[model samples]
Each structure stands twice: as structure tokens, then as C-alpha cells.
Target: EGMDVVSFASSAGPNNQQVITEQQLSTLFSNVEEILEANQKFLLSLRQLGFEWTNNPQHLGEAIKKHIPPLKKSYMTYATNFYHAQVFLLSLLEETKPGPLMSYITRWEKEVIKIDMSPLLSYLILP
Candidate 1:
């Protein structure tokens, strides 16, 4: 995608060309929605597991370790979807008239980073 964008940009003259169309925008939006839905599902699954273990740490730790593979898989899936969404959004920003994308970029830049639990859970479960 980056190579395609670079080739397109190089071929163009001084003035910017409208490379993105309404159809492309629609498709990107749909892709973003799908990514969001998947993220929500992953988060919901994690929350459910957390809730289930709230009363019993030992049992919860065991369950988490037993389920590590699925949790890691889901986390990786979510991360990939998130990266795709970011790329799509960045492409849209460069190809279309700017609007809220800048705000989103700003907000994202300001957001704090936290530890991911997929790897952390194993250490946490160790006695």
C-alpha cells in the first residue's frame, strides 16, 4: 500500500490529484467499522473472563493460563486489525480533504500506553 501510494504521488504533477473516490471512502469506512467490531468483541471477551475470576484469583489464574493461547490469538488479531485501521485512516487523510482525522491523530498521540495482559497473565499466574 505504501509503495502504491508513493508511485501515485510521484506520477502526479505539482497540483494534488483526487486519488480517492466516494466508493473508496465507503469501503474504508466499512473496513473501519469491522475492525472496531472485532476490537469490541476481543475486549468484551477479556472483560468477561476478568469478571468470572474476580472472586477467585487462583481459579482465575488457572483459567487464564489454560486459555492463554486463545487470549494471545485474540490480542494479535485485534492488533492487526488496529494497524490496518490506522493505515486505512492515514491513506484516507492523504487522499481526501482533511477533517476529523487530524483531531483523531492528536487524540491518539496524547493517549497513554499501558501493558498488554496476554503475556503479563503468565507471570501473574505463577506462584
Candidate 2:
């Protein structure tokens, strides 16, 4: 009986942790103005060509054919950071208690269901 109680208590810790972390994430995501602003900035940066726009595709291709390096280094850096943030958020969710986490999920699901987000969903799943 003592061993059973200890195991139950240990299991309860992870559930509590997951709930707290999920609440934290939900609160963080709740500010729509800031989220929209950051998203707009990210899209604007992607659309900007900088110096690369001036290059002729055929000529640039031929010139760098033998010694080409990867492009979009900055974009890749940002993508890596974004992926890390998602993973961190998920980890926090897993660490939070189940009850509060469930409540957050319920709220978030309602908000998400109300949004018309085909474009945003595509971007979220992009490589």
C-alpha cells in the first residue's frame, strides 16, 4: 500500500506540471495584437529580396554553378528558432498538470475553431 501511494504521487507530479505549463503557454498566446504584429514582421522580411533581387537567375546560376552555397541563411536561422519555440511550448504542455491543461485546451480549441486560418495553418506546417 505504501509503495502504491508513492507511485501514485510520483505520477501526479507530471500531470500537475503539464497543466501549469499549458496554462503558461495559453496565456502567452492570448495576446492577439502582439502575435499579429510579430507575424506581420516575419512575413515582410520574407518578401524582401535585399540584394538577391538584382541578380539575373540564368547568369547567377551559371556563375555559381560550381561553387554555389546554400541560400536563405537568415530565414533558416529564424525557422530554427521558431521550431525550438514550438518544441519548448510542447514540452511545457507535457509537464503541466492534466486538469488545468485540459481547461486551457478547451479554451484554445474554442478560439481556434472560430478563426478562419487556412493560410496560417499552412504556414505552421511548412518546412
Per-model TM-score versus the true fold = 0.31, 0.28
- Scored by lDDT, the top model is 1
**Model 2: per-residue lDDT, tens digit, 1-127?**
2122113322334435533344444332322333444555554544553456467455444434422222244334445555554554466456655464445544554666678534322333333
Cα lDDT of model 1 by residue, 42-106, tens digit: 56656777766667777667655666665556545545555444566556546555534334433
After the best TM-score superposition of candidate 2, give how far the Cα of residue 50 lies from its true spot, in angstroms. Answer: 18
As for model 2, its CA RMSD to the true structure in angstroms is: 14.2
Off by over 4 Å in 2: 1-73, 98-109, 116-127
RMSD to truth, every model? 13.1, 14.2
Q: List the residue pairs that clash in candidate 2.
A: 15-97, 16-97, 17-95, 17-96, 17-97, 18-95, 18-96, 18-97, 19-96, 19-97
Least accurate 10 contiguous residues by lDDT in model 2:
1-10
What count of clashes does model 1 give?
A: 0
